[model samples]
Target: MISGPASVRERRLWMRTIAIVNQKGGCGKTTTAINLSAFLASETRRVLLIDMDPQGHATLGLLRDPSQLEKTVYEVLTHEQGVTALAEIIVRVRENLDLAPADVLLSALPEKLRETPGKENKLSEVLEEIRKDYDYVIVDCPPSVGLLTFNALKACTEAIIPVEPSFFSLQGIARQMETLDLLATTAGHNIKARALITLYTGRSDFAKAVAEEIRKHLGDRSFNTVIRFSLKLPEAVGHGLPIAEFSPRSSGCADYRALAREVLADEPPKFAPSRVEEDPEEAIAPAPAAALEQAESPLEPRMQVSPPIPVIGEGLFTVETPRAREEANSLPPAAVLEQAESFLESRMPAAPPMPINGEGLFTSEAPGAREETIPPALAAVFEQAESPLERRIQASPPMPVNGGVRFTIEAPGARSVQLAADFNDWVADEMQSRDGIWTKVVPLPPGRYHYRYVVDGGWQTDPLNVHLEPTPWGGYNSVFVLEGNNGNKVH
Candidate 1:
């Protein structure tokens, strides 16, 4: 199949397809699917939520009663010519958001496709016809693996697995990863999977500990944001409305927004690495000094340096001087007597001195008088130092009026990151990442500018900068404000 755009203008309108799946029930799979989709749509982008499950929880969660719907996903999948009239079946849940409803009739999808050839690719084919119409398409998969789930897997570019903080859910993660591996081998589909923690109660020590364990094992595959448990979530579902619409101020709404921000920050997930090979001899480590010296370079070196020896107490025996023997032979009788007297004096203890408050250097009527005035000698020293003849005027460094703006970002997985914005007309001026950190300094006049990091064909906001401007494309532009004033705050 052909991938990427045929023209430069057409490349900006590409779509992302995602599937939310987990075999375990009551793990908040459907909840994540609905809320995440709702938050993305809230950003003013066209989003389609596909309810592929027969239970139709995603459909019910979005205020669409499956019983009242005439043509649902069940009909869309069973009919041979249903792909042509998909627009008729899809209902608009709200502005910039649409839903392809499903009902219990969807449970019979497997038997319906039993005799059909290439059933696995049927859903992918159907979605291909309308994929260009929206920015994102989210598929809500069922709890069990079957023809329906396989079709969804074939259609999706990425998968999100929601897991609860419990032992049962923790054990299910390995099985899910194994299933993805098998699908990749048998079906030739590389679907990127990310594990999300849902229904997390931060107050529970056991839950927090289990969540940390899952994150430690999953590494980068697990999301940084945890969807906290909130009573408003179930209440919103019962009312047949997404949390954004049902209770906008609730924790459920805040958690989903945070999740959406993370989703927008990432590039298209790389499901697998490409083929590459190296010789055994070449793969072996070089000398430590050579490695450390050429660490900034991309390729590994092939030389080694020997270890250095210690200078102090590094060997078994100590060396003696000849001058010490001559001094020992020349000792006198009087010197011996003086050494004995000194030794006896060192062994004796000395008496403590008396208090000098009213007896010695300063005999003042009150203790405050000593503290209030410095000694005459010290006062003279301070007076000379404070004199204008001794004072020096130091020069200050000049403030930056207009100069280069150093833009840096760390993207270890990216092939190359380019600075694209109004300054450069969004061109891919390549910048190489050294030690996983990419940097580029561009000279510009002091003013506000909007920019983004385009890493390996994926556009992302600057993670280092908190100042952002929402774009019409349902994302953001990293904003930088440089000023001539020395004390100006950065944006």
Candidate 2:
């Protein structure tokens, strides 16, 4: 593939999505959807809530107007459309929450349902194209479990239902379960639904009894945290602020926070995505640094990088990582191989003959048996090219000779990095190498100089240097000492 700008890769990594929905109307679904999304976004998790409902409540809750959207999810999700092409349509409503705005045109869904084959998975198809852009995608569903609701359920990995602690809410569980089971088996999306009790009350006997009844029905399926009935919830919705920002100190906000944490804590289920054929890249084992760290680290997927070079010959060069390819780019593979062979050939000097002896036991020696003469020219080159990577690696600095200073020593990655010393006013840095080596000779005056390596445009500690101290975030920092307090150079 052709190279793209780096920002394109950066926009892909922000994700961990959950679509909040309930089939029944008047179940606090929209309130839970927007507030939980807003609270999660407030926690610094990048979120995008797709409002699949025709009522456009989630859209109106987040945006100034829902029907006014010129390029809504309806158009943006078309086969001719994609996220990058429609990113301009996705408006930034709050800090990290972006809404793919929708309007009431969806109210006609029942009439047009199944006009196309497998219409339920349309949203899923579009979402898969841009799954990397969000940490959490909180989708708000329409009340009737219509075509739009089916599409959202098919697209989302998990679902959260805000039940109003009423008998009818529990009664609807059977129908909702049937929908989830059908989508999981037919559409190949095993969507998990986390049931949450909304409009909870502590003092009222009827509220307590209703909450207990719902829990008995749900058992471990319902979330442990109950959203207490509070006036702030409705007020926040009317003002278009998430309870977290509107009335953060209220119980409603706290309940959503706890529920959001639980939802975030659940593991993303492993399901086989619908595909006819898979690529070698998808089948290959993921990089341990990235895939294994997914649950722990916040790294997004890379935008563009070439595939690893297939190992050939004796495998002298191991795996082709981002570092190896970069260094290899400086010297083409053909040139590198040519140079290595030449260096090896230089070592195979012509065989020499042994010395002649006297009288009866005299033996004649051929030139092959004679002693070989060492040439100064060949000897110097031999020493300099001892290592294959040495063409890029710098040699050790000068010793404690006059004006030689052991100001500092450190190196990080192998090609094209920099280092700055406190002795140099932390000015321009000397370049570092890609073969994991660096050496610099500096004429310094007196005092100890603190130094650090600036690698790949970022300030970092040297992997080779030992004098390290803790910096911010418990990261290591390199410390340099100007021994003898005189102008000198040391490796």
Candidate 3:
């Protein structure tokens, strides 16, 4: 809809360009790109999936016959004689989702563009024309690194490297990361690269161990959503449909949806009113000098900016120490409230030496003989007492009521929390939050269960329940046993 270069530049600011790249084959790179785009589009976002891979797996996965296509991304990128618009090759795959299909002919791109001066920037330049048209542009790179992959890296602002739970996959990731770092240093492009664990089978000890190692090393850099191995996934692709359409109830569909939500969560907020007057062209430019300076090293997370304030209220009062403020800002609302209560308790005397009036008010005795009563509303605010929810969570482990187990965790500051357990095939179930406590009541018969909590995209064992079992990977999982109708904490 945006016409001319200026309007395109303005629209590009809101668009998220992501390239799915992995030098290793059979790592679910194409599958991730296709399904992720489909799920994103299902969420009411306009998505354009560009098949940069010459093999055309993404195109075939969407049921688009590349052989019949007169125009593809290859044609648009080559532009042998005259310029070919990317929109001309795009075909609608689903509602709100479009595809620019590719075929084996694209494999010749490197040899053709080798003589071109700005060949690496071809995809980047071509994408500019339709930058304003879609909310997301997902590029499916070839399995091997070449000019095509370089073009993808050059164009995208974010990259996802899908690493399956295999020894070979693990070895390849280090090389893949090195390539990304090389590009960042040489090209000076700021691309936020993240590792996605795919084709994971939790039942296999080897798979679990590999996954744990990836998480341990990557930490927050790796996605918390793991794509569990599913037979329905390959079957759906064979049927020329995404897992969501082919088997909506399948684990494959659920995992991809979770991945899409994780990606959407990281979307940057829109520019403030004050930044409206800034030049649009400059917004799409490479990282500024300030951003570069913030990065301690190229391997570290780039473009380091102060984390956004938590949704909870601002600090209780002006913080005197930078370290204290930083620690407070990182804490969830529940922790912050506890800290405030402790601060209040430390400042107040153990006994006020005041008398309770007939109206249940605290009356202070003074030399002037004037009765000063504490207001009920004001007094309630200053009360250093735990809420009923907090007390219940602290007093008991998951309680079984009405043939269901109620799991609870105190994390008031977390924007979202999910419970994943072996009983549910490790699929994360959203938990409801009240005050600073999160609870999920699941109906279960007598059985043993292993579970973990995912808070704000970080996975961890339940802190409340000390009884934990060591996992295959050097981590722990909380254990709970339901005997008859009553729940028992596993020792």
Taking all chains together, each candidate's TM-score versus the true structure is 0.52, 0.50, 0.54
lDDT per residue, candidate 3, 177-252, as tens digits? 9988899999998789899988664434455567678877887778877676554565566567887787664556
Instruction: Give candidate 1 regions above 4 Å deviation.
Output: 1-12, 80-84, 267-491
Better of 2 and 3 by TM-score: 3
Q: Whose lDDT is greatest here?
A: 3
Residue-level lDDT of model 2, residues 103-176, one tens digit each, is 66565554555467777767777777657777678888877766788878877777787776555667766577
Decreasing lDDT order of the candidates = 3, 1, 2
Give the Å shift of residue 332 in candidate 2.
Answer: 74
Residue 54 lDDT, candidate 2, scale 0-100 = 64
> What residue runs in model 2 are displaced by over 4 Å at the alpha carbon?
1-15, 78-88, 109-113, 267-491
Candidate 1 structure quality by residue, lDDT tens digits, 416-475: 788788889877677666667686767777566888889888888765443355578766
lDDT of each: 0.61, 0.54, 0.66
* Model 3 lDDT-worst window of ten: 350-359
Lowest lDDT block of 10, candidate 2 = 351-360
